[model samples]
Target: MKNVAVVVQDGAEPFGLGSICEVWAEPYHPDDDNPVFEFVVCTAEPGRIEGGSGFDLFVEHGLEALETADLVCIVPKLDFRHNDPRAVAAVRQAADRGAIVSAHCTGAWVLGDAGLLDGRECTTHWRHADELAATFPKARVNPDVLYMFDGNILTGAGAAGGIDASLHLMRRTFGARAAATTARRMVVPPHRDGGQAQFVRTPMGQTEADTLAPLLAWVSERLDEPMPVERLAAEAHMSPRTFARRFRDETGTTPLQWLTGQRLALAEELLENSSLSVEQIASRVGFGNAATLRHHFAASRGTTPQAYRKTFTCLEEQSA
Candidate 1:
């Protein structure tokens, strides 16, 4: 997408707007070829807009800016209950014109108000998922995901979820290379597995010391080694069954699930930062072989290892 218009209204959340700007508004990259988006902040009521932090921002553009945007992003607002009809109409118009219409946090409410959420699969910040679903009965809300993209309409959960959704859109539009460049510049992971479920659950235990933090660290360090539940249980000094129970209690996920996630993360790091072949990365991350890595990587990341590497290889390394 060439042009991006961020819809900001009164009570806009700074972090949400900043997240959009970080991904789309940043100028050209120094190391890689990346698309530069013409990012503009537009409001239904132009001029001074109040932010959620009680700060006032002078927005120069009106809703008219959204008409020419290739992507229309709605920044989170303080109250999802109150939405301006003018802002809602602009969102609807943008969506009707086939521009990607995305929302961060409670911004989904604006899409709902625009009647764009009807019969579409979407998500909002978990705290507001129920209300979003109840208010828009036709919209299918999956609360557990970090983000959901249905057609050209995308929605993210709260806070950092906006970053995740924005990166995803970048990857979708400009290829993984550009997205990885932006992510590296932002110093954020290019992709994150799992969902808001990990955040919504109460801490596995009240005190950090009450959980198996040590065991987790140990396992992370030895991800290249074989780690069956039996080995992990032994490391934790508990029976296999007991270890499994405590693992779920401590991490909100099973031992295998956690290990696979760690391996995948390491694999992604290797793919982006190293020149290792797929088979070599697979061996380093305990996936054993290129075929196995391809299976798991595609299953978890929706892209093959070779393709991912090709899209995310460091530009410096490429020239060298």
Candidate 2:
């Protein structure tokens, strides 16, 4: 069993806290045995810790709970850049003692404030993401995933991504079957690959909400089909000249630009999720051949498709 510590502060949201507790609060009996973790919840002081919800969260333990932890998990705060120094100090001490440090959601910002996130891969709630990347260029800021595990320091994306982060920890700790079993019991997906892109944005175009959504969706769904300016104008029910003007007005770019983004999105998904050859991906994503796909993938992502897959693929390799 692992000595796991969950560190919380004022105004902590229930979702993030509850998600961690849901997984760690109990034990799973393999042979109808006891719980697997010796879980501890610690706040700055004993008694009640006020959370985002109306109710006050009471954790009997204090910072001392981290002293003997084999793994110390930081519950994300609402505003990490301005958190108290003592909270930051506890984080440092836990990491200093060789404890596996984990941060969930905007909790990663606390690790960032503690200076432990430097030179490591991390993610945070997308709202504060620009500041995190701007503040710490040395750290690899992956704003796209549910979580990241760079060695012992694991950082999760947004609040909901806590499930993915915790499940990832289980996968590494007890193996795939145990993780899958826990997920099934909890009624969550076994794994979510790619990034928070699938979670964050509502796809390439919800142009219908504004003036451009339908036009964008129509073009995206037919990537293999030709998207001529005149043809698109007809879809929008406007003359070619008027359509071009409205397209720019609504999306702030020409129709072709939006089309490029959608195609690139598909290309990346195929590369990360499938064993499809570059040529096949290119065809599916509207690019004519491997050369075009390679050019765009390298230019936009700074790496080839093959290399990206090797670095990010999380599932077991398919057997022949």
Candidate 3:
């Protein structure tokens, strides 16, 4: 069995650490006695580490365990301002000696700090994309995706993106079935394509405060028409300024940002599932032109719509 080591610090997030154990350390199944990994969750002190949201974690191994690990994982911390070089060095050293180094969420910053992300493809929580790119200019930051795996070095966004990264690692190591089994045990999708964009801001028409959902549905229906904010505000029954503020509050972004995201999603679907041309897709998604859609897709997805479609487009029909 390949050995996996998860590195921890004083202020690591529990979800990331717990995800390491949940997917890597635990047995794959009771009846299936074949186990794929011998996992270790190690920290500097092998004791208690405080986490975000006031949770405390206890472990039994320390940094010494990292030397023999086939894979090393770095989990997120409560504070991003201080990622000790000692921890970063250990991970770098492990990677240098042929162990795959995997960092989840904000842990990508540590790898960047260790200088491993230079000229490499990496990703992190969308909120930290700017800071990460500015801090490490050589590192290519792709903010639109769920995760990016460049050879052995892997990164993920915040929240449950850690799970996506973990499953990705499993897929490469054990095969797609093993990855799917582990994801089922954890109740997560095993393979959400890394290219999928992050959450978009929209006046979701749904009643779940997705004020943009309805407007967006309405917009999709009328792709030939301009989805101006004033028109959308009228649909939402609020003044233009008030509607914009409410949309931002509910979606963590502006109406235009949300609209652009929806258009991008539509473009991707049209590219992957349909045989639509770039200009046709642009018009269908409301960008109305290939050039305009290309600019927005590049801005929002960090890749061109043509490239995305070429990479992700399905070749055949699915069972479902």
- Tens digit of lDDT per residue, candidate 2, span 1-320? 37999888887888888888867776776643324789999888878887877877888998888889988888876656667677789889989878888887778877888888888988887666788889877788887667889877888878768888888988888788877877877788868645664433324544443776766767778997778899998888999999988888877888787777788777767766788887888889888888987787666555666766675555575332
Name the lDDT of candidate 1: 0.86
Looking at model 3, report the run of 10 residues with the lowest lDDT sum.
Answer: 198-207
- Please rank every candidate by TM-score, starting with the best: 2, 3, 1
What TM-score would every model get versus the actual structure? 0.64, 0.67, 0.66
Q: Is candidate 1 or candidate 2 better by lDDT?
A: 1
Candidate 3 residues lying further than 4 Å off, grouped into runs, are 28-34, 193-196, 202-320
Clashing pairs in 1: none
Root-mean-square deviation of each candidate, in angstroms? 8.8, 8.5, 9.5
Best by lDDT: 1
Taking the tens digit of each residue's C-alpha lDDT, what string does model 3 give over 100-171?
888867889889988899999998887788899999999999877778889678898776888888887778
Evaluated against the true structure, the overall lDDT of model 3 is 0.78
Per model, state how many residue pairs clash.
0, 6, 10
